[model samples]
Target: MQRFPSAISLFAALSFGMPALAEVTADDVWTNMQAQTRAMGATLTAKQSRTGETVTVEAQTIAWTLPEGIGSLTLTAPGFAMVEQGDGTVQILYQATQTYRMDLVIEGDTATLDVRMDGATPHMTASGDPGDITYSVHVAGGMTAAVSTHAPGEAPVTIDVVVEGGEAEIQYRVTEGPLLAIAGQATSLPGRFDAEMQMGAEVAGTVFGTVGGAESSFELNLPSDGFDILNVAAALRAGLSLDLKSALESSDYTVNLDFYGQPFSEERRWSGANHAHFSLDENRLFYDASGVDAGIVMKGENEFDSPVDIAFEAAAASALLDIPVSGRDDPQPFALRFSFDGLRMGPGLWSLFDPAKAIPRDPASIDLDLSGMVRNRVDLLNFRQFVGDVSGLPEPELISLALSRFAMTGAGTATEATGAFTFDNTDIETFDGLPRPEGAATYEISGVEGLIDTLLSMGAIAQEDALGARLGLGMVTDSVGEDQYRGAVEINEQGHAIVNGQRMR
Candidate 1:
């Protein structure tokens, strides 16, 4: 998904624009695009012919080499025209049905993409100067891309994607002090995708899906002084900032698989809204995503001569992460959070394990929230060196950790804990070459005793095992109420493990 933005930025280089002081000419737009393409370490070739106020470009090709000599991408288009509007603006025209071919090579494998763009009324308009330009694009009939991938000693894969009613507005500006700023908004009415794969003789699969609608917007500020599209590490080190947000209305998909004459299938659907956000800067990186009301159903056959059916639903799910990206002398702040709420399994799935309905069929949930501070001592932006050899990198010193919340609830039982800790990096020898942690944490649990009893009654656990579990619980936790227990653990200043006020180490 992150690659999508980078690909859009690459295409932005080929967009046309000019200054507002004078009537923009076709030649100006073409020259600006060529220069921007060259800046990104890509080659652009095209032949131009001018007639009156229109400039026609034909046989256009753009080729870009991937970093580390890992792969390359090349796109070729038939032709297009740029018409001067005589009012400091230019109108870009495209054929009603435009076809394009893209060739890609990764590692030792190759893939080709055939793209078809259709529009009942598709058009683009560009205005403003070379330093600041605004472009608007609209495609009524949308676009479709079919990709065929071939790898050695593997089955070939083909994927087809279609997007409908697409539109976008973009703003590009050259800011002061070697910086390029870009902001854009895009929306699509609906989309569909399909993929098929076949192996030798017995294995094959197909996936088909559709999305209701989607909208996205993004802003980026990239260092232009020494910008190379292939060198993302350099851009990050030079202080790149980007913010991206997107949302989807709904989505659903179905997958079918066949293996050695056996057939299996699964269907998944998601309703309500789904949203995601990602942002990155020189100092830190952050990302968040959430979904509402999702479910899945699967069916297959097994050796028991019985058909297998399983189903589950989730009311909501969300996750968030924030971490520092650059090294700093002082500790930097970070946080992570994840949660899944209102999870319920269908009776078919539950009956397989609990045919007598001994266990409660209640919705389950889990959550975690953590924050920490750490001092980094290595330059993470040195990508090649960091990937080639990580042993030379100094270990980051843990400063503090806070588990604000941790919880799980299901099957008539619940458990939760909270804790905060600070580390002593200077006294590593006290903890055997590791930083000593000083903090206390407490936990509460309910329904464990009753659940164990029920399992014992159902013969799920032997009597001796259940007795041993009860004895272990009694040693660690004090019974606070019926079928409930509470306990606390601490790491004292002297590096002793204390459980319920008793020193254990």
Candidate 2:
């Protein structure tokens, strides 16, 4: 146990957001808590176990101090002593030969509870029912804990384990403060393989949970066959490793690359490292996938015949997509290859932004390699229609929903339209049908109001109109819920022009 601080900070502050402050004396906080817990029929016990590590507290006697920070207590009790509490909230302070130790501190009203685990900081907290308790545990230099559910008297089970800082950061919670940027990377691939990565990320915002932050370079490598079955067959042999590195947010934008792997895709691997850093406040992104030589089949032959030499830094440039990302999702380090039929991805991308911006003035860009083959229908379609337009080219019989082939290499901007733009196989693109000749020209969104302040500056759409259209987009849809997303789209011969989707006309 050590001497108590004059300020009585208790490591940190905690609360359950409840509006009740039941008063308990310092003596009650110590003994009364256990009595109340036992009344709950909980099997609570305290035992002295030899921990391999040393605790920072000097281990003084047990007692509690007043709100004015007067912890000087001369206890005449054996070992330790303090005040017991009702409502299960207890405070225990201890006094050693020359030092003082604090066993616990409980607040009866706030619903929020926190317990210090032998360390210098509070390790756990509880609120609401016995079903759950929140924690802010620190492992190494980071803070993590689980959504602890008590289940009445269920041996105190842990719901989820979240480690942040130097290891893992759960949600918007950081192990360290904004001063320490979380710099770590994680990867997951096929073949029963998984990986966890760490990155250096620094939050530069306020404690109130606002947006705008920065990250340092993060690196991670995992074993997998890559994204699609198309890459699995030829990429099974490993001669390289995947590395995600050099990440930062600068004045212009935030940049990062998924490029750590072998130099060659042969049985002999090299280091495939993708690294970068970008300016802060820039919500645009550009990706380069030219090194990946594999493609779909075209006309029963391998039309993606760019020779699988595997030495590709493949694009002249990348697109700067103005997209807003939550700080919680940035360091997550996740990737998936699951594809769906008629999966409209346009709205999903649009959803990433604040609803206040309806049309992005800053055009988003993308570059890629799509010189592949497909034996069946059209390569890709714009959102609102089926795969059409093949009268000038050789006609292949329409059989299964198998894809057609095409050679594509260059850059294309996402037109002010609502449709997922693809740089690779057009098969991933969607086309329900061109819009009707006169049903609706362009649907305007209204009522979004101030939901997209940041988006307005990113050039996505005008702030005034964005306010008008935001929520209304959902109301016009067919369903309601997390998965419910819809937009009345229009189409033309060149492609489909989107409405509530984007272009957002």
- List runs of model 1 lying over 4 Å from the truth: 1-23, 35-40, 106-110, 119-121, 141-146, 151-154, 159-177, 190-210, 225-231, 258-263, 301-310
Candidate 2 least-lDDT 10 residues? 202-211
| Candidate 2 lDDT tens digits, 3-108 | 1211111211111111123343332222223332222222223322222321122222323332334222221122223232344322333332222222322232
The TM-scores of all predictions, comma-separated, are 0.85, 0.19
lDDT (0 to 1) per candidate = 0.72, 0.25
> Which pairs of residues collide in candidate 1?
18-129, 19-129
Cα lDDT tens digits for candidate 1, 192-307: 66666565567677777777767777766666543655445568777678888888888888888888756755455556689999998878789999999988887877677587
Tell me the deviation in Å of residue 217 in model 1: 1.4
TM-score, cand. 2 vs. native: 0.19
By summed lDDT, the worst window of 10 consecutive residues in model 1 runs over 1-10
Model 1 TM-score is 0.85
